[model samples]
Target: MSTHPQSQRRLHAKGFYDEFPRKGGTASRATHYCAGCGHGLLHKLIAEAMHDFGLQDRAILISPVGCAVFGYYYFDCGNVQAAHGRAPAVGAALARCLPEAVVLSYQGDGDLGSIGLNQTLQAANRGERMAVFFVNNAVYGMTGGQMAPTTLAGQKTVTTPNGRDVETTGHPLHLCELINTLPAPVYIERCLLTTPANIQKARRAVRKAMEIQRDRRGYAFVEFLSPCPTNLHLSPLDAAKFVDEEMAREFPPGCLRDRTAEVAARPAPPPLEPLTPADIEAVLDKCVAVPAPPGLDPDFGTIRIKMAGFGGQGVLSYGMMVAGAGLADGRHVSWFPSYGPEQRGGTANCSAVISGSAIGSPVLSHLQVLVAFNQPALDRFARDVEADGLILYDSCLAEKPTTTTARALGVPASRLAIEAGLPKAANTAMLAALACSGACRVASERFSDMLAQTFAGKPALIAANRRVFAAATEWCQANLRPE
Candidate 1:
């Protein structure tokens, strides 16, 4: 054997996976980051600290949308991927939910400083029990080397071809200084990773941040002045020199705030309780009985309904009523709503599933009952109804549907509601038609109970809705066939 010890021959963090093959198939040992990038070094340091502290099992590494988005493939511990600039919020939630877990939020300059500035500030301001590692590479490395919020003044980037201009683009953001200004953060430090001495200091800072988190101390932020050689158009050695000579002058790596000694450990969170039927009943008010109507096909116990209309037409509420009726009748039910950008005068729709058995999917492409409140709504969703299904439309539509596969029924729902002195109850009139026409198996008493529960606060409108429901039921009974 060679004279060199096993440790001397090779070194790797126990907390890190054996290989980073996903980063590149060519080199199983190497990472995907560009040569001279600081992310690899930072990752090794953080992983080593976690391993040395015996926190590998209890650690949760949160990687957001950035150069390190694929960190889950490297770290052996519990990993959570987050949306761009959402790592801090995810880390805060994990820390709160699992008090014993050591949470780590790793993010780059663009993600933490720009789009996620508010989330970062809020998490720090609350003194969340976690550690945040901010890598300042002065450019968006992963997404085509764009100019980031922390890009140095006079620095040249793809967006800033000539150079970063202070007059047009603001100055480089100093995260340590900004976070230090806050009262909640316990420890805050800025360190460079270019030189050997600086690397030792950065390693110690990383350990200290993790140690603080282990003790349940409040927020600790460590800013690393990292390099992005590929984006900066510099060689690996030149990138280190640039960070040491030029970038360090602007950032000034040092401790901005240290309150670790003065702070106490946070209190442990309470244990979660198991959900009980009594708890469900207390929250849901009550559970009634479901009796299938006579006209429904006994072969299929599930009813998929879709309601589409203008935003002000109460399409969402109409679906909710069906779902609520199912819930009250002790059936499995789900309701989902979708709408356009504009709240009113815009198209809106919702899907609901009311079944005696378990609900597999909340979304339905083929609806058994479709209620369309407008011509556009009818045109958009009429084709999706099953061939043997029912299509109910408001009589106010200027153009009627041309679907020959499904049974089409046009009712004066809005006109009847206005006649009953409640123009806004058009949705209830359609629901009444659904109930009386035997399209839905729900009883009128259950619908009345749901309306009572829905308009409990607005008791005056409940009576008008009952009258509208009665009129629609009578009209459906007189004109519409049960089958």
Candidate 2:
């Protein structure tokens, strides 16, 4: 045996975790990719580059929904798994918000080229400072062997068993060529992973992209012609041979555009200053016309309310009025609206949450109060009211809705609004009923101020709504039992 010193063996990259406990199996040291997959090799190249650059602390990897979706399990940096086709948008947000972050978006051909094509192009067009690594394996390797946007013209996939027909499916998308047409991208390249020399070239391309990110240079995209042996129904060697011969012919590997030397580094954005209480008060004073009530209680607990009706019935407006009143009472409030496509004839609904403490979410599943403007609204949402809660519906509804758990009341809101000389003020009447019945904890006297603030520029509507509110309150007091 020769006495020469043996070359030092390479260890795992420091950018990765010592152990992937998230995998939850004995094979924690291995990735989830199939045997002889190119993803493992590409991941190593990226992690090694990150480690060398000392960017492991500032790097944030946005993983997409594909075989590599488990990237968070291996990468030791900040990891966020975005929804399928939304990685580019998420990456853009992180780049803008965290200027010091080295944002990296990892996506497969199916995720980036198909559903996420628009997002990818838009982000590139805006010249977002990030690095995007796109893997084009010809076919959808993760979800069975389906045809992808990068699949060759005559490639045979499960969806295209007879080979992709250009007549029906159109021509395959040349993504690098498409991106090269844009002016904002600073670098665009395509590399291969078939041979050892080609793999080294791909490593150079990966390192170059990360260097661009380190300098805060605008948009760098690197596409890799990778192998997928299991999906292609071929041995590892045959798959690499296929990529070397057929795939390379379709997507030639080389740099299409490189302006890294010409582009200057972007300046880091100033840190965001936290808003002070006085700053918040100043903004609220300008936005909110009605001042919060003096000496208001801050520990009123929480109350949830839902309002539903036809689109033209102002159901969403009623929910907003309640939310606005809660705000004026010095409580935390949230109003969320849901409506159909049609402007006037479709169904509409909204949820309102009022609390003295912090509100976690604006969505409400169960309600302390349900206000329905029509029979359909009552039938659909009456059962969602709590057992000790209250249900109020328009008296004009065709039939009275029965509820076994909660007390029910029929308010002549429409008639009262008409009598008060404005049919559009019916929403104000509903608000008055809710306040007078004690269903919501807000003071009834605050509705007049809320209406004044809501119609700040329009004086006539404010007077009309106040009349409707008074009529509804008086009617409820005389006829409906508070119990």
Candidate 3:
């Protein structure tokens, strides 16, 4: 099934989600990645676990930066692209949002050790109800060769061109030794992805992590000392040999923590008043704020939406604004985001599902409305809209396409936002038009309240955003003219 570079050009193309399997299959089959990159093997193991468990619908994956960033494009389950070092934070939120779903935090050396050190360790120590997978590739890839927290003493990377000098660069980070001190995790193991025999052993560790999730156990961690040939500028064979000879000696593989037996036999943590969403979701199947007075509408047909656009497009914050309004209206709400490259000039997006009953299966396919900021966004997702659905776009760009089944509207949102005094308020403008299409029953007052809360400290700028939403509403009413 393997093909040459020329034969797999489409697979290597940026934004190319190469494979689309019909059923239980290795969902990540597109392999244009540098040969011997341990990320590919790890991705296969994780995806296989997800599919084998038949928990695809009830699984939330938090994909970190580094080579693992594209984990979402192939996995059939729900995936969240997390900040470089904050996969654990997103994993914590996943446990809060869908308590029944299996949540996983996939991270790497530079991300977990350098930036996300605090988050990963804290999550493990406090026993955050999620599983975290650490990919310990001694050196950092993607961002050129650089000495990572786990880099061997003599390894040469762009940042450590003279090979890492222990005096200055210091020694490799032993995460297994570090996390072993935590009390609550169910299982912890270090596995190496060196050969077929070792790969099989890693598979057991992968299963153990998933089993912990299945049993509703607390925190679990598995760190894999992997290889990176592209960054090392070594051949596949040489890289694997390097991992065996150099990497394994510095950070040997084995279990670091396990409390599954104790956890199962021990009593549960005492319940407290639920203030945070995580506490609420953990305590109840669904969570909603105290209802408004009797006059307010008590029930609503929930509409789960996934919106995508360019970075700084406010895709996530705007979705939060809508989720906040849902709370104001006494409706149950949940907002999840995909970070990482989105924060770095790439496309950013989020999924918001407002519901009356408790929400289930957050994997969304047929949204009622699709919003596109650029042509690529539209081309990639426009077809996912349900029949008779609606599409909205920025008319200023020549990126929009004519939709037959769904009503498509292009609005001069950025220009209008500038007129409204919030020059970078295109997110609000675009969302207002989508709301007008009955995608979200957002009221002006509720939106104003969200605006106030969002800009809580910036009182001087409140009027500008207030006028902005009002203008967007007026424009929507004039054009959409919802009858």
Candidate 4:
């Protein structure tokens, strides 16, 4: 009779498991961990906590390797994979970078102890505002079973064939004991999962730590003594008993320390203010379109142009320069690419749309101008030109000529650069030629202004490129087009 009776579950063969939410969140993917793993149980508890506390949006999970590396695969939150044992450090940096975000560092014993001890201790000492969920099973289950830093003495593991040694090996480091010593630690508890009752207790601790994070409290750490039956060479039931009798003795179930008073002693963080309308107006970055000249006929549609060459040929900058020239002329402009596998040490190509109306997409369509700087580039984009559209290519064309009806202008860019006494200014030379060609709507004064804006900071390079532009414009007016 009740419409909202309870939270529903889609039952699988093993029974009803928590259904992963398919909604708007950073982590919307299903997990891929093995069966009977503690991670899924813990993930469910954490997700429920985040969902209940309404801190889902501000939460970021820092996943470290071992079992919890793929914690990002389930938690519907902003997730980042931290380096092994470095989740604390990652958590610290994230807390510092975006302090508003509630950082959760999830790590295993191998990740936190064997390799990441320094990072863990340092982060704890720093009083970094983060919540750490450490699943300690006393063995590294990921890369074959090996004795971990928390492995109890006389525990027979793969690495410790004759069982652990108390003298030569040294005593197992107690993380709860170590973290308890740190002044900034808000909470530290060594919880176990040997029994269903204890699982509930651990879950409560987990929820409490998260609640602290929700209230903007300082550092909180909860270590779960998870079961690893496969690595421990015990049946599931036997492993549960081993954890209860053996593991629980060494790692007693109690609170190491609580600094909630310090949290209460501190003043609450300031609330965020609303954004004003004027502030919104000032922040908008509007890119004005290029305009047409005073004397030129405005009948022609905006001219689209393409520039292509090897990686160092300055195709992107050249295209931007041409587009900037159009911008100065008061026309709308957009620049994009036709780049392929040639992008890596091979040729590069860019297309620019200089139009009177707003551009739909920045992708260069077929039947526009084609400017190719290499043989492959010319060969690749030659036939795609429109009947009236112009084709500009460097004299460095080392391939067979195309007989396309589109008007073609071949400027010996390399020769022009050599004559100009600066070789790298070749692309700038080709750019100037395109400007003087009657096809584009950009005015001469704006073109010069654009050249200044495009190369404003570099004076020597600007002078060199200016020579190239001037020379190319002179050559185009003299030989290729009628003024």
Candidate 5:
């Protein structure tokens, strides 16, 4: 008689990926976590909970910039790898956007307690609908064995050579205690994974947190007091003992807050309603009719403009005026500004795109019209203009560009603004010159209208800007040709 084969009892979660492969096409069944590390155990617990709750399909896991960064490779559910300490913020946003989806933020002690402390705190205080799993290993494990915020007072790390200095670094932050003070979070608990019994308790906490998310409840946090054997310079057994004894003495493993009984499940958000073409047209029709220049090429699909100057020279404002004019003309527009470190002395630039059709990208590599408000601005952006493009430079700048294949026009913007008794209206003068020279597709009258709208709050300056604009337009008409 043939013997019946015994079935294997599967312990691994079906939510985990079949295998984690290296970039070079090699598949490895083993994880990168060190032996006796708590990450593998924690990952298993969370994955199993997700599998049991049937949340794998609706789950979105946000992994922080630490050892858990490779969570995207293992978790079969949706994964978003966030910047250091920003997992909570990202998870909160994902939860809000996908109200029905279960969002999980997985972070290490350094990522959550150090640089990302503010983000984590704010998310918990807001009672965002999500689950946060914090693994407190008391050391920065990914970059190096550097001192983490949760590093024990006498613990030795790369930064804390002899031991942690409480006077200078302060005591290890009790995250659950701090977060518990907030009124928003529905559940806040701390658990350990050192012993088998502790592991069972931790697994239950993980499942409970996931269950709250499945029920569409408010914020829930579970911190795992885990072991770092390699960094702690101890064997697996010794590390487990350290977590159970010394670490637990500082960070007692138990529930700090549990309001699940009092809290009600949040209602499911309304489904998104699609808009028809007529609805979109009704919205677009509200734009003011700013006429284009006469005899402008109807085939002109898009125009790319780049404006650059010193930060205080209103470089961003000039680009905004151009974009505003395009919008007033019922055209699609985008304005992107780039500023250096200091807002005042730093270099500032902006790219404005006006398109008859949908604007695909705000970034511009080559410019159709380049406006430079100073010598530095001219020198920096002259090479980026197209061969047949137009370059409008301030006449006060002595440095003339010679490398560009574009046609260059010099405008006395500063002198003209001063002549109009408004030294700050230099950018307005350049806008007028751009219209008068016919380098831009928009009509000169449309630019004047935008100037009126821009300075509407300061009615006294509107008259001075219009005068400066007229003067610059006259100068451009006489001196420059319409290409």
Candidate 6:
């Protein structure tokens, strides 16, 4: 090796990998960004700061969905790639969980200023300890040249071919100005990346934000007005000139808020003590008020059930009861509910999964069982049942459902509930019908215990619901085949 002076030899930042293996190929030494994208420059500044502050091991960089999503390929520190516009939220989680670590949220204009605006503002408002690097290129760089929230008026993009219409699309969002209005942020600055002097200023701003993170100071936001040559249909030199002349006119670069000197460093959170199995059990028992039972047999397999009806029809309650029974039987269970805005008359549905083993997902596509309380529910979800699945509908409906794949049975659930003097217990009647059909492998004793636990406060209605359930069971046993 040539013995060159330390200052004369150029070296890569310590925070970055020696070679980007994720890029793969002979060009692994190069970045994936276009010729004049500002992401490369910003990445260099961040990596250098991480190296200088000795924060490489403690840094957790959150990369948002955009051109910079490949940040994990270069940054050697902890990296988390968030969904489109969710970097700030993910950063908040990391900041809370790993309070000792420095969290950085790197986002583009389209990702942060548009879809992630709420998460960004909320994190800043809550004074989350994280550095937010907002690269404002004024256009969506990843998914073609779309008009971003920060796109200036009259700026031409693929979505706005004839220049942006102020009347239809509104003016560009001034993110720095908006963030400055919030009180929790410790430091906020907007820097331009154009001329040599401006680039140096931006470098300082990036370092200052990292310093706040190093000190564990509250929210720090640094916005960079960067160039996007390919998207702007301009040469690299022209793009730099465009950012210096035109973009700077709209978004003047300067320190908007600086409380770093006034704010005290946040005290590190106390170390968390590990909890033993007995401690965890005690906590769960206290919180859930239920004792853990032995798990069901492996032969039980997995059962997917869906219940649907009007909002006030206790559809969600039916799913919960099924899930609770599964829990009491010592089986893995999941309940997912979906409903419309209107609480009473609107439609509602819920999916419940019971399995002898661990459950992968709660959402069911083709269900083993579908319980429909109304004609609309039957019409909507009847065809979703599997070939050997079972469909139980309220016999009170005026129309009969047509299905060739599954066995459809109509039970007088509403009439049975009314006869039992509990009109709202139709869902309980349907549950009883399901139990009698043997589609679910839960013990009958567990179902009874679940009912008692569900209605422990209402002593009067328990007997009535049990009557309704027994009537539904008898009707199903006599009329329907237990296929």
> Which pairs clash in model 5?
none
RMSD of each: 16.1, 16.1, 11.4, 16.6, 15.4, 16.2
lDDT of each: 0.85, 0.85, 0.75, 0.75, 0.86, 0.86
Q: For residues 352-411, what per-residue lDDT tens digits would candidate 2 score against the true structure?
A: 988887777999888888998988788778888888888888887635666547888889
Model 5, span 1-483: residue lDDT tens: 223333111434567886765221342545667788898899989888898889999999998887777888788899998988998888878887777789999999999999999999999999999999999999998766899999999899999999999999999999999999899998899999889899999999999899899998889999999988878888988998999998999999899888898998778797556689999999999988876544333466789999999877888989999999888777778999987522124578999998876776899998999999998788778999999998998887535679988988888899999998899889999999888866667776888998888888999888989999998888888888777
lDDT of 1 by residue, 1-483 (tens): 344667632445677988776524555666666778899899989998999899999899998677887788889898999999998889988987787799999999989999899999999999888899999989988776889999888999999998899889999998989988899999999998888899999999999999998888889999999988888889989999989988899999998888888988666677556679989888778656566454323344899999999888888988898899878876778999987432114468999998877777899999998999888778788999999998999987625678648988888999999999999889989988777767777766777677887888999988889999999989988999878
Ranking by TM-score, best first? Answer: 6, 1, 2, 5, 3, 4
Of candidate 1, the 10-residue stretch with the lowest lDDT total is 291-300
State every prediction's TM-score relative to the real structure.
0.57, 0.57, 0.54, 0.52, 0.56, 0.58
Candidate with better lDDT, 2 vs 3: 2
Candidate 5 local distance difference test against the native: 0.86
- Candidate 3 local lDDT, residue 332: 71
Per candidate, the number of residue pairs that clash is: 0, 0, 0, 7, 0, 0
Off by over 4 Å in 2: 1-11, 274-483
Error of 5 at 219 (Å): 0.5
| Model 4: residues with Cα > 4 Å off, grouped in runs | 1-31, 265-483
**Candidate 6 vs. true structure, TM-score:** 0.58
- Candidate 4's TM-score reads 0.52
Give the TM-score (vs. native) of candidate 2: 0.57
Which residue pairs show backbone clashes in model 6? none
